[model samples]
Target: MLAAMRTFELSPADRFTFAQRAAVLSAAYADYFVPLWVNAQQMEAMDQIYDVDARRSVVAHAGREPIGMALLSLRGPRGWISAVGVIPAWRRRGAARAMLRRLLENAAQLGLDEVWLEVIEENAPAAALYRELGFSAARELLTWRYPADGDLLPIPRELLQPAPVERALAHFAAWHGQPPSWQREEPTLRHLAARSSAYELWMEDALAGYCVVGERPDAISILDIGLNPDFGPVKAGRTLLQALAHRFRGRAFTMINVPADDDLSRALAALRFTVTIRQWEMRLPIIAR
Candidate 1:
């Protein structure tokens, strides 16, 4: 006989079990284009920020075996659903749909007016599921990366200085044309402030642009970069890239997520950044009844 599946809210006190379930789902969902793994440290950080009342975990059980799981996080007004997966053997049993429905209900109860998520471009099943739930295509995001070969540009290094937090925040606020839900706002700024280093590019003693680089064990991730839209994309991007490379010589970089169609994307491509994968940013607007 099979036990009934259950949905529940995971509190901070349930850290141990939460971590275990998160790891299991991450492993089961890891695919060629969608790498959804999270380490213990990252999980701890997530638990700290994700509102327990808004977050949920659904587990489908048959007998004593766990067959499927899903996780959601509420960041400010946005509810983010991530790491939804069913073990290969247990797929096609409606577990995914049940988990998603429960998550959406939880999001509504939490007073979130919107929900957002990302699906790998190649994941048709996941994309279809989101579409059925009223998620529409917002934009396409890409991850670009380049190897660090100790190559250095001849640009003067004096023009670059460490970015000040206040200035970086102001600059990010002024950035336009990015999706409302996709903008790197307070939380992202806070994360960047703690885990990354920034550099300000100066031309004639004026701020031309700025870039933030986040260092990880495997690669240096370019978290954010903004240039004066007037400077022309190619020149501005090259200047930022050269400055970044000079700052961290001999270190490889992997831009985890960036706009697929942005001017910066073209510049990075010109400098030999290969497209690793593409993802569709999906948005669901919670209409008031």
Candidate 2:
């Protein structure tokens, strides 16, 4: 029988210091599908990249123990539910729902025009919950992986030139075929450039594309890549990926949350990259535009 009045309680995450909140999130996501194990330092870095607003986020407590957390990131009139997770023992106990409800309430109070989030396609329960909260899937995002030993495509490196990360981002919107995910947005890319390498492609004296790569302990991620449509996105993307493969040989590569309908996926497929995970980008409109 269920215990009477036994339920998770919501608290403003800002009540805790950054390090304490990071520890809470780390524990909550310890057994997640992707299994993130970020320390306070890493969490701080992520907060900067995601524009997280701790004051607008929430933590779920069972008694005095933080058993779950949900982060909210605000960018102008838009708010993103960056993450929502609960410890294994606390699953299906109303923690996630409580945290999410609190975040939505916070966003609405902040006068956000819309709120966004992504849910792994295979996680039916999470998807359903977001839908129940009035979120609608806007698009499908794909995570692509390339094996370390995969055959590298034959492409000339003559036109590929090393460049400042800012140079690449200067043309981001113009070169990209579709809108980017929040993680790949311009502000996030700028923050990530401190730890990444950037390069650009030139075709007939014109800038054809740009690519930025960020290395992890076990893999190299394509943090951002943009191909000018006028120059043939697939062709330009192939050259860019080939350059990345040659530059970082013997390292597995991952590119997360690329829109499924993006033209760049063709180049990825041609270069032996395969989809590893699919996610749905969902949004809840709070204020009419």
Best prediction by TM-score: 2
Q: Which ten residues in a row have the lowest lDDT in candidate 2?
A: 1-10
Model 1: number of backbone collisions = 0
Superposed model 1: Cα runs more than 4 Å off: 1-16, 49-54, 57-66, 150-159, 180-184, 216-218, 230-234
Give TM per candidate: 0.81, 0.94
lDDT of each: 0.67, 0.85
Q: What does candidate 1's lDDT look like per residue over 40-142, in tens digits?
A: 6676665554433323545555544556666676677877775577766556777778777877877787788888788888889889998998999888888
Q: Which regions of candidate 2 fall more than 4 Å away from where they truly are? A: 1-5, 157-159, 216-218
Candidate 1 Cα lDDT to native = 0.67
Top-scoring candidate (lDDT): 2
TM-score of 1: 0.81
